[model samples]
Target: MADSTPLLSDSESDKPPEPKRPPRSLDETIERCIGGFGWLQIFQAILVSLAWVFDAQQTFISVFTDAEPSWHCADESVCSSFSNICQLPKGSWSWDWPAHTSIISEWGHQCSTSFITGLPASSFFMGCLVGGLVLATLADSTLGRKNMLLFSCLTMSLSSIFTVFSPNIWIYSALRFMNGFGRATVGTCALVLSTELVGKRWRGQVGVIGFFCFTLGFLSLPVMAYVNRSSSWRTLYLWISVPTILYCILVHFLIPESPRWLFVKGRKEEAVTTLKGLAQTASALTMSFSNVLIEQESLDDNVDIYSSIRILLNKRWAAHRLTAVMVTGFGIGMVYYGMPLGLGNLSVNLYLGVTLNALSELPASLITFFLIGKINRKDSILGFTILSGVCSVLCVVMGRVWPSLQIAMELISFFSACTAFNMTLIYTLELFPTCVRNSALSMVRQALVFGGVFSPLLVAAGRKNNLISFGVFGMAIGICGLPLIGLPETKGGVICDTMDEEEHRQTEKGSAAIPTLA
Candidate 1:
């Protein structure tokens, strides 16, 4: 306490205060550099989105290419697809379509082996589950967004092309697994990269593009399948494979590395170059800073990079968010992937049924975009999931009475599930820190695949009892959404760039009281 106010000399007192590290925010710098969303940025985003297109394509292609075609029995004694051959004349019991065109007819899996027919579809999801878990950290660590995308795209393309050479169902299923494994990182990396390429103002818009692309890819399946209806199922695989390979090559040549990633990696010069290229492409003003930077590097550059899962788990609040999000995603995944596959059991028009289901995506996307802006994500997801569950029960109730009405109910169910799925995509991006965003999303995707893993089996049993099939789907979606109600409204929260920032922001958010109008 001695001479508390008399310590500073004249020279020391005159020294200018050391500038408070310029509010050093890396996320702010990235948004500033990206500026307003431009046409050039849109082009890049579109090109990168090819990954999303093929991801959707490969996922649902089995609905047509692997379907069990309609068949009549040779005789009451001889069985076929849902028909007793013994009840019909010998020559009248032939397949309605050529055997070579479908996996079911071609392999004689129609009657006796029908129960296990779901193995291949289940196998694909299993592969996705394994691959997503194994490769979840790759994008966040070494491959970065562009390279991870290129790798996933190439792997999926090559695997699909090789599927054309499968000798039997065993070989075909193996190839499908490989294909699923290869494509595992595509959507996660593509989504993360696309959002990262833009500023906050355009993030929601950029996010919307992914849903549209996925819907387009889903829609393309029916068209491609319709065109190849007379052709062998192998043609469908080859159809998607060849074009996919060419597109991947184009993607390799076009898309740029995410500059934010470069900056975080201490590659500031490269980051500057990427920013410059973006500016030049858009014909916009270049950044004019000779001294301080936007604080791109992390505060602890000396610390070794940790896996996203580890980082997420280390923080209590982050761990809580991760658990809730992944669980909800799992439930949504079951309905989203399982409903369409289960629709094969519908007695209505198969082609028309799929077409209607694909069309449901458009409304889902539009609705999700509109609702996400108005209310919070938590409510939207919760509402849509419960609706999907209700519709699932409705599908069973109407299934036996009116097949058309049943199919109509099923369509609504798919539509609701699809909306919930879309919400999960954007909602996930908002939950985690940017440093490990890709990995976190990938982990959640694996959780989704885990749920998808069991759906094929459910669909297989669906024909026997609609209750068991749709009931599980209903319960899964409805129950999982309960935990999400506790999460705060993240409608206007900024995407946190680092663990420290996310923790601090969440702390502030927890302590702050909601304002009430008098």
Candidate 2:
């Protein structure tokens, strides 16, 4: 035994010295540096969240621009105002509004097929889908969140400028596609960057800031469109696009890169500098970043832009979590995006109905903002989705008898959806670690947008039958939440910074037989 002791000691010494574990983890260190959600952090988070305002503007702008205008009988003897515009002779009816007020009136597509009318909206969504697939990993790999966000807003605004000059519907549709492509990364980047800039304690609330800004944007459109009711759709585009260009410039100069992202990318010096700039006190800035080493696996700056996505797919647990969240997001998105667009089906005035729905988002965002720390992500998603679906279905059932009740039900449905949408995004952020958080969130957003791709068609079809759009929205959100049962609850769990760290946590939890909260 005495002779063998030397060999054991030698073997122990031969093993590489375990990297000195920091007294505090990177998350804890970051939390310490940010000084418990300082005002500076709040200001930055709100600044980034403002991007959602423009995003929401671009998103729902078509609701007004492509609207089917109110038509009047040019010759009342031949046709009434209620006459089917498609069946009437060209000179028999004319638009009540100016020809340039809406694309439908401007381009003489008032009587065009639904396919033609919905084409631009659908093309826009397709651009979002393709753009998400292509740009999802760029934020995680090369550009970082701020740069990617800046690029997206720049592209979106520039394309909108070009859209002002579109001579035909085809050109307008193509430009709308470019706008969607550029806008695809805006919400995701903003959400991730805003949340990442703050401590975990404030992440949920910070994330909801974007939702509030989005509601503001949604509300702004009705006002903008109404004020410009007699003006050309091109003017509305200019109003939205020009300010967005100025916003991109502000973002470029004002926003800093996410420190967490920098740390993951092996840029410690920059990460430290960012944290220092964000720190409210000189003492907090004094904490040494030297010991805040990332896991060896995460330090590989040579990782390809697509590596984060591949990692998500290759890992069975991540794949399952991703699949479940994405499936659930698809349902929430269908109602969230579809409801407002389908509001034209309600008996309320289009602008009033849209304004009411947009207003509903305010309460939804507020609820999430206040209860974020206490809300259970899975339960909230499930409950709100179920409620949204029931109300949507009830809208179809009760709409014919009481239009007021139908709009109320629609508002309730949208409110629930907005809350669920907020939670879904926050939930997605919690499920993944820093290394792949952007990619995972991007994929989930793609799922959301993918659902929206079908919304215009459903809204168009619902023009004739209420059951198609509202009913489908009800069924999809209600049923899609079941897969969440298989995913682990992320509430109160510290977010990890690397894939290996996350996997280790899962393994330890599994070994300890920890039960997940519903």
Candidate 3:
């Protein structure tokens, strides 16, 4: 240390200090480019979120289309209001409406076994399950979010239009399968794409926009079904499909691909241009993307279709998180999907009941949007599930003594389930890094549809007994939310863009926990 202060010359010391470099991580770069949650980001999120509207339309459309219309006594002496139409003489009892109004009446499935009546709904969910498994990784790999969203939406819309021409139950069921297969990725892609378009500060809020759009779609169904109460069920398909096709056209023309996806796919230049276009300020536009230093593993130039899924499976922590979320989603999905479909069994007016159930989702979406930052994802989900379960079981218990109290309890139960459903998706989104985010989300949705597969059968059997549908729904959601205890909380945390980055973070945190032996 003899000459420590005399090393530099006077001329060298006179030069200005070098500027410090900005963070090169993709997350930071994205935040810099986005600048703030501006109108551009809001518009982009709305355009992408509109997909969930059509998705919701397709998901609950069957509730009205497949419903069995009211029946009446053709011969007063032979049949009464309480008589079983299946056992009553065919001529003595006739449907209150024309046969063409519902699939159950049109296809002569009213008196058929429950298995036959539940087939179309079950098949649709099964298609979702299979399609999710087959198409899940494509978004994370070659197709990317925008293309996958476009393809899946277009396919779903076209199939829905074709469903209008079905001649029999077999053909209708087959077409429903195709529709479900196509619609499998709609919500997943839309949620992921919309959130990815925004900065971390707005991701959760942006994601909730999709749920609101979905609610609008759900709300629209009851109105449309009421308007077409006496019209053919096929008309509903056309009404939803034509508008969806137009939406697909708009998406194709207006939406930009996700910048994060482009960068990870080794298309850096496109990512930079996309980021620049999203930037509102002149300074952000001028900021160079040249020195951004993402991990090499994130740049997969030729990522295989199954590569993202394989990556998720290979990681121990990722697998555990995936399993936990999926189990929780299954519970939420059963009640979320089943409750509306089973509305016919309730004593209230079908359309009014459906409207009430649809309206219950409004506060859920608003609550999620307004309090997204304050809510703890894991704890909220657990609490909602327990509340939903309690309300659901009470619906059954209270229905015996106070019949009017049943719908109110059911509404609360469904509302709780809806809140839990929204949080589950957003929570799953944050649980994984960007590289395998879509694949993980798709798997969770498949678990959701897997639970829905049994919904129709349960709803059908529950016609005679409420215990089968509502009772099981209560238990499933209550138990499924328990696994969240073992998972880590992600509230107020920065999301990672790469597997290597996330791994390094976890490793460092683990290392920090070890105390010195001194």
lDDT values of the candidates? 0.78, 0.87, 0.87
Q: How many residue pairs clash (N, CA or C atoms closer than 3 angstroms) in each of the candidate models, in the order given?
A: 7, 0, 0
| Candidate 2 Cα outliers beyond 4 Å, as residue runs | 1-24, 291-298, 511-518
Which lDDT tens digits does candidate 3 get at residues 1-518?
57667678889999999975523566677887778987888998999999999999999998899988988888988777546788787799888888899999988888898888888888889889878999999999989999999999998999999999999989999999999999999999999999998878898999999999999999999999989989999999999999988988888888889988887888877888888889988888777656543422345535589988878777777777899999999999999998998888889898999899999999999999998999899899999999999998888887888998999999999999999999999999988888899999999999888888877878888988998989999999899999988887878877777776676666656633212211
The local lDDT score (0 to 100) that residue 31 gets in candidate 2 is 77
**Per-prediction TM-score:** 0.90, 0.93, 0.93
Give the per-residue lDDT of model 1 (tens digit) for 1-518: 57667588888999999965524465576556656777778999888876788999999999987886766665545454434543455475787778878887787766546546766787788788878887887777777888888888888989998888888888888888989998888898888888888876667668778888889999999999999887889899888888878887887777788876776566677767777667633323445633224445543222233466787776666677778889998998888898888876777777888888899999998886666667678888899999999988888888877666888788888999899888887888888766778878987888788888878888777778988888889889889888787666677778776777766666666622222101
Candidate 1 positional error at 92, Å: 5.9
Clash-forming residue pairs, model 2:
none
In model 3, the clashing pairs are none
lDDT of 1 at 353: 82
Scored by TM-score, the top model is 2
Per-residue alpha-carbon lDDT of candidate 2 for residues 449-491, written as tens digits (9 for 90 to 100)? 9999888888888888999999999999999987887777778
